[model samples]
Target chain A: MKMRMLLVAAAAILYSSSSLLMAEADGKWLARVPDEDKARVNPLAGQAKAAAAGKIIFEENCARCHGVDANGLHNRPSLRSERVRHATDGQLAWMLRNGNPYKGMPPWNSLPEQQRWQVITYLRTLPPAGAAGGKP
Target chain B: MFASPAFARVLSWAAVFLLPVPLLRAQEKPYFVTYSTDLEEPGNLEIALKGLTASPKDANAFFSPTMELEYGATAWWTTEVYAQGQATDNDSTVFTGFRFENRFRPLPREYFVTPVLYVEYESVSRADKSILEVTGHDGISSFQVNNSQSHPIVEHSLESKLILSSNFKGWNVSENFIAEKNLSNEPWEFGYSLGAARPLTLVASSQRCTFCLQNFDAGAELYGGLGTRYSFGLAQTSQYAGPVFDFRTPAGVTYSFSPQFGLNDNSIGTLWRFKISYEVQQIRDLFKSPSKRNAQ
Candidate 1:
């Protein structure tokens, strides 16, 4: 009995440490993506096709306030920013799956993975700052 | 295209009937009217009058085309070639010349309070010199012969303007200053203007009506006016010459008619004038989109 209890304690400690390590690694990965290819990589690599698909999703879901180009009309932050640019694919997927309670960002879990990716791909095409040439 | 038959008829009737009402109630608006027996007067009266009479929508829509070419010989200074012209009432004038505007600001925004120094050599010429000379005087040449009577008008002017804007609930206040001098003659003139704008009601709607009051020259001139800026549609205002009483319909169209009265410069008698304008918006959407190529 004494040996069993010792073994159980050891196993619990090992499990907790592994989770802590995993969390740290996730954070490191998030940090690396932003600092690494931010200025070098073209964020809009496959966006043209993705945006075409995303436009349908945007019109159906987001157009009431965000307008056509994701340029918010009233009081919404434009998707054209470093915040969106730095968001990892997984982070975007998670945000779409799980809604933020504090802000009005709604949970879009009902959307399929392909549709969510389409939206993400389209948002990536938006300039991280400044207005476009012929924006209405 | 959207003006219905009944609506068009009603608008025509309103224009006919309300046209005289503005003249009768000229004291309640923020516009003054002056006439010119000689069209070639020194001031921008023609442009100002035309702008005043133009439909607010159309006036805002027009680009007021301008082109300027300047050369700077030194680092801190250079010469500037300035040319600006606008056509209205089938007539226009081009003012072309050079100006030396010095750049000195204690603080960039402080320019609002301090005057900007400008020394200019300009040639103001009529768009139709032949017509003007024939109608007004004989043997009046365009550039050479008109030296004595039509010499280049040289001006050294220092202008300062201030605009303070804030909103308390629904009220906004703005102040303007304009001061200038004729370098050669040393004739100095200054004007101060204060105005307020506010909404009339708290209806949660896209359309907004703003009423403004401006007192000019320290109460020497007073003007009160109302305007409504619409969303999602076009309002075209007519381009005419005179005072303007402007109003916007619920359908996102603007109409302005004004009767003007003011004391003549000689203080001899009050001047009375009439003007009308129609505001049209969103007319550009009817045209095809332009090529996206950048100019060289």
Candidate 2:
């Protein structure tokens, strides 16, 4: 009985420590996504037409905080960074659905699913870090 | 393909309305009560100097200049104080009493339409023609003789507006429905404004230029008085419509100009409005108290 109780406490502590570490990662927001969501792929990816549509949506809805070029403004995070570039399509979509309010990002869940995918499609076209055309 | 004359006219108007819809939006103060749902950055100060000069067909020309100090108290809240004065040829220049105003936005994110609430308290003479808050003044002659008949006694009033704004396809459209009441005695009066504006260009050049077309915004507005609560028709109405031009400098200065033409005999024949403002919102990191700094 004594040994079982000791093992239970140990397991709880280990579980809590891992959660803390995961939430502390760069962007920290990455840990919030469940496995199923993190692996989903964008249906509209690589579609030039969808990307064109996304640009309009982004300008009207996202440009105020993320900036017209998606370079970020008013200390908002730049969507063209490595974290965004490396993030899976599902992860991006999930973030939009469930915003990290603590970080000042409002949920775009009100947007239609296809519209969200379209935004992801547009985002993928942005150059990675160190790209010449990126904002200074 | 060009269509018939009537169709062509309609298409031209549509093009004018739709061409700039995708341009990004920036905060700009309008000439009239047409307000966009833009809140100032947190803890920033913007000082604006604005003047409007009106010409009546057979009456004296007069101008009212107002100095407004606005502060962003929070992300969703802005507060302002105004001191107004008017001058007319062969008439005394009187310092109109001051006004206090506040605007609040309830939503945290952009939407198809955003609604903002505006409330203000003003104390001014009956002859004040700043038109900052258009209430019951319907005749052009009222503005012509405003500065001449300045009474020592001041009148207190409350004004409110339901400002509904929408940002879609990069175009921003705003409408203001206004109601005002005198503190002493009077039925609630009504007024309204409609405006549409967008930047001339949306694409930012890689090489920076100061006077680029992208920095200018051109739009038009229509506003008028809608009479009192008891009398809800256009029996004694005044209306005006005109183009507005705004230029924003990289150094945080904005200049706005507008020339308005009245549509009725009761309205002023021509009205010219100008506004210049300098904003100090960028130095937030260096300063601890912006309001205190402004006070100094």
Candidate 3:
């Protein structure tokens, strides 16, 4: 048990100092998205339950960084901001597929293209810069 | 102690219960040998227990358990440390040494075939049975001797891989080219692996419930050695191919399983492997930022 305690203590130390480096913010990724990519359309755009289905995926994959309300968390940017609210569905899809890695956001290309669009569909439902969560 | 089945079970159970308390991402791949281009989210840590059991025609049946702790320090880098152990049915269990690995993606965005560079340092005994990677005539002499005879040959090696992966529609295809060199005057070893996987369903159900078709992935991988630099062929090597399955829970837990069949005379008849992993996101923020804590 003493060894286990020592391991726990070491882990606590690591957990505390591990933050010495972490994810941060970037702005240039929006400009880097190719026009062709920006033109890609969301196939699930107008489906009635698309946003509802997207909310489930958004909560599973993005809520940790983006917040359940899509208002953003820590230093991560909010999806409810005017920039995101006005982003074309294709632009949002491009961002999801190609993250702002020059800063710290990892790409979500591992997710299916459909899931990326689904999350975008869900993002469209969030109110701008508020503490509300709804999908209708 | 770290390699025992009991210890592995305890760790897996702990991850299942403790790691799923909050929401997390679930785009993990299911391949056991081939790596894909997905890196852990930055500032997140993942803990996992992986095990392999195989009955080699040459040696006693044994189980090897590996404990892995992976951390994402940056968007393009994920680092992992592993503790390994092996136990035979009639023979005693022994703790093999450790391995440290880092995978880096230099690009800032997606490419036609995303590339990930991997480097790992391993200090393990000859008795090591995890068989994490098969490289260069490994099966010609693998498991040919008893653990007592092999355990004393402690060797240190450097392993590297060039991983290429692409996702089209809902399917993911990946390939890995491996090179390993022993620091103690051994020739370079080469290996390769290929994998393809897709989610059972592309469309997600509105409810985030377990047992949903979208939560599962099915895949397969083929891996084998390609002999040493001096003798560069498959003249004496082991090969295996197998199907893989992965189940991702909404609460940040992942379970993976595979059963591989050896494809050559030098290979083990069959191998079964399983792993359980948990993702803990932004743990630093969880501790340091009161504002972020409130938002969560």
Candidate 4:
């Protein structure tokens, strides 16, 4: 039991460090957003139906990189992380519109504005990091 | 005085320099036609070397080797340019010509049946037996004659296709309705192509492996000539069906191969085809604004 607890602690430290590194890398990407854009609110906020529709869209497209459960894959950040949870709806929307190509996240501009907002609504419903299961 | 061997050497060297370093988000397209709903990410360039060989019954065999450069101009628009050349047994090798092609998707998101418009302008010699397309080519004798080394008919033609594609349960199906018209005043010719494909695995593995079957896709293509405007029907048509495979490396190089069999006398039997592609830099990053460069 003691060895298992030590291993868990190590994994947690690794996960936290990786997340910090990712946040540092993404700082430039987030900085591009205007102050107004970051503060914008979701027009379709809390719409359960839109979120359901967005779930389908996300599964079709985003699931390849983000994983079927929106947990993330191949070093891709988990959508349920504190960073994603803290990002404003408008900021998230702006990131979707203008992707950080340098970092490999493609712009979601091809999706309709309504669909983008719907995806944001769906994202808002995900459990925060460590709420359901801890990931490293 | 370009021998096939010498040409091969030159092409191999060119491919070495043309192979671009891999980028993170580059998605490898699995098929030439019956394209997946996924589009090339904007600002990326992909290069491909495609080869196809056809042998008609008791006739001289011929093959086409083409080099293609593709650019994603936007999220919905992709453009490509091709340099085509051909070689025939007992015949002289020749550089047929080039073609420019574009594909555009109008819809922003997934639809019931996503539609893409394809247009191409080709300038090739009659001796060009690449058979990249099979339109209005229906006579058993036509294959032998069309591929005759003695005849080099220069043709400037416009080709168009309406591509309708859909995806369901990880399966992608696409159908192309084709139309071609010659600048030399020939009647419009029609053709069709259908493709269905799926990845070997729908789930990603925790460990990345270059030779993993999960990184590969298996598919099939069926295409044929639909006769010309002046003459319509399958009475004189060439049809081909084939199984295709694609292997994508982690470094962004994709290799594709196909073995096509003729379904009719008008078509050539046991045609073998292969293509290798590499992704280049995104156009946006290649030509970043001065302000962005400074910011970086």
| Model 1, residue B161: C-alpha shift (Å) | 2.1
lDDT of 2 at A71: 74
Measured with C-alpha atoms, the lDDT of residue A108 in candidate 4 is 58
Among these predictions, the greatest DockQ belongs to 3
The most accurate candidate by lDDT is 3
Q: What is every candidate's C-alpha DockQ against the true complex, given to 2 decimals?
A: 0.02, 0.04, 0.48, 0.04
Tens digits of lDDT, candidate 4, A22-116:
33225466667789989988887997877776675576457655666777654556788777888889888888866554454655544556667
Per-residue lDDT tens digits for candidate 4, residues B1-296, read 23456346545755674565453333554665455545565445777788887667866666678888776655566777788887666565678888888787765444558788889999888767667777875445754654444346778999998888776555678888889999897899998889888777653433446776556888899888999997877768888888888887776677789998989877787888888887664334334356643331
Interface RMSD of 2: 13.7
Q: Model 3: how far is A78 from its true place, Å?
A: 0.7
lDDT of 3 by residue, A1-136 (tens): 9569847854664564344333445455667778987788888886757788898888777887778777777667778776777778877888888887656677889888887888888777677665455322
- The segments of candidate 1 whose C-alpha lies over 4 angstroms from its true place after superposition are A1-69, A72-136, B1-49, B52-158, B185-187, B199-260, B263-296
How high is each candidate's TM-score? 0.29, 0.66, 0.89, 0.67
Give the runs in model 4 whose Cα sits over 4 Å from its true position: A1-136, B1-26, B138-143, B146-151, B289-291, B294-296
Which one wins by lDDT: 1 or 4?
4
> Per-residue lDDT for A1-136 in model 2, tens only?
9559847754453344223222212588787788998999888789887787677667646765566777765456678988999899999998886565334454554345666788889899887646876775
Write down the RMSD of all candidates, one decimal each. 25.3, 15.8, 4.4, 14.2
